[model samples]
Target: MASIETVTLEVADPTAADRFHTAAFGLGGQVRLRASEAPTTGFRGFTLSLVVSQPADVDSLVGTAVDAGATTLKPATRSLWGYGGVVQAPDGTIWQVASSSKKDTGPATRRIDEIVLLLGVEDVKASRQFYVDRGLAVAKGFGGKYVEFATGSGPVKLALYKRRALAKVAGVSPDGTGSHRIVIGGGAGPFTDPDGFAWEAASPALTN
Candidate 1:
């Protein structure tokens, strides 16, 4: 089965982005950085999510990110879905730190359970079919609203959400232009999706 191996974020300063990510999330090799002068504005059509164990973990991660130069879009708060907060990285990428549990079972730690790449697409169903044709199996679906792909042991899980809705969730405007400034390194191939997100063949070094 095809799975995402690594996510490459194109930033103006690779060194700075590397420092920020390492200090903020300690993501290791699953997320990579590349130098680029890509012209991008507004939302950039997606958000990266860090899923943690509990509310305290959410706060911990969010706090660390803010200290690492990330700007908070939404303060961590309880909601129907649990606790979450949104932040924008200095390199112009949006990240959501979230948890499904309202209460903490233990002391907070910076352990992240999952990293999800949520693409904001115009049509969830069409993007879903497009990925399905590319060998990604749907793990869950919510009509035409959302779809998540099975990642197995891959470092990052992939999911789709309507553009406007996703922007609202991330507390950003849906309007964006220029390159997505992100690339998916996976088993899929060197193809661009309907939403213009690029994908490349996975590199063995990315897992090393």
Candidate 2:
């Protein structure tokens, strides 16, 4: 089964991005950063989500991210699905800190249960089939709206969402152009998907 090993965000300053991510989410090797001056604007057509255990954890991560210079796109709020919020990093990457549990069972901690990379594609069904053809197994699907791929033991999970719907979920406009300013490192490698998401061979540093 193909799996996503790491997500590399192309930023203008790797050092600053590293510091921001450390202070904000304290992520491990799953999320990496590299320098790039690629011309991008508005929404990037993708979002990186930090899924936690409960509502408290969601608030904690979102609060920390805001304090670390991230702009809040959506304040932490409860919904039928769960509690979550959206924030844009100083480097312009949108992040969603979320949890399936709406209520807190205990005190908050900075523990993240999962990291999901959600791509906003023009056609979820087409993109899903594209990944399926690339040896990725479907973990979940919802008609032509969304699809998630099984990651097995991989560090990051991959999902697909319609571009307009995803933009609405992130509280942003749908129109965007230029580079995505992000790369996926996975076993599927060295290819660009239907939506132009680039995937490279997983780095030994990340796979290990």
Candidate 3:
């Protein structure tokens, strides 16, 4: 069984990137990927990389994504990274699909190591069942309010909270357009969850 280990996104403007990261949630500083060393390859926001070994059957691994009503960008295929794919999630975000490779990229530990990404959902029970129905085992924690859905590599943590409460957690005003817009490789769209909390998802842009 393949699972997603990391989720990456690309942003053109650095300042806006920081703002989005801040507004989406207070996942900055501690969770933000360092850019000093890599310079050009610095990360933009929180990443939730999936742990999918077989990278080919991406559709099979992205069951939660599918249930979230993601829009497929490119079906499973081989790329410079590995067998992977991209999708425009229903919440207007791009997601990545690939197997972790500890190659010339340096030791995985050297890379940002921490739980950086958390999917904010409206209904915890429904989301939990959705992932479980797709064969993902829910790992409860934080007194069951928080959960880590197990995948082949690691797991994607599902943080349950109301829209207002979640906005506070993300450290955002919950104002503006009241939604997020994600752009990936010239593709863009709007997305949201059951509770009317919108988001942006896109595959990491190509840069080196």
Candidate 4:
């Protein structure tokens, strides 16, 4: 199964960035600090989504994020699809914490089960085809409005969205600043997508 080994973020303050995320989200994602490589602004064009199995987790994560210096984009609420909310992490990356149903995975053994990287692009069809050509199969989608691809059994799920619409979903503006501030490694990578999202070549450690 294909899996995203880890995500790499270029930030001016990698330590602080890592600290904030680790505290707010409790999932392990890596950060790289390169003064010369850091972008002037913050992340845009994408959102990191965490899927839990309980409605209460949606609320808990949102509260945790706010306590960790994240700004609440949307208060936790229930919808027919489930319950969830959005927040902008201290480093300016938006995070979505959600559960698709009301079943509790249980507090004693609960953990985030998935991290979906949703890219906001100008055209979803083009982006979908781009990945299809790179060997990713469509797992699910809604025409060109939104689409998710099979990224193997990796912990990360890759999906595409309409630029402004995705931002609206995250409760942010579509005007992304600086670089996209992300790197999705391990698939047809070392290449940039149509929107300039970076994907690096898989390293030896990731080959297994």
| Candidate 1: residue 98 Cα off by (Å) | 0.5
lDDT of 2 by residue, 140-190 (tens): 999999999999999899999999999999999999988999999999998
lDDT of 2 at 91: 98
Whole-model Cα lDDT per candidate?
0.93, 0.93, 0.40, 0.77
Please give the TM-score that candidate 4 achieves against the real structure.
Answer: 0.88
Q: What is the TM-score of candidate 1?
A: 0.97
Q: Could you tell me every candidate's TM-score relative to the true structure?
A: 0.97, 0.97, 0.37, 0.88
Candidate 1 whole-model C-alpha lDDT, 0 to 1: 0.93
Off by over 4 Å in 3: 10-111, 141-144, 155-160, 175-208
Q: For residues 1-208, what per-residue lDDT tens digits would candidate 3 score against the true structure? A: 3233323333344454445444332233322221222222211222243434454334344443454455555565655666555544333334554454323233222122233245555456776665565455665545334556554343233334343444443334433333222211111113334443333342332221
Model 2: ten consecutive residues of lowest lDDT? 199-208
Task: Kindly list the per-residue Cα lDDT of model 1 for residues 1-208, writing each as its tens digit.
Answer: 8999999999999999989998888888989999999888888999999999999998988988999999999999999999999999999999999999999999998899999999999999999999999999999999999999998888899999999999999998899899999999999878999999999999963432
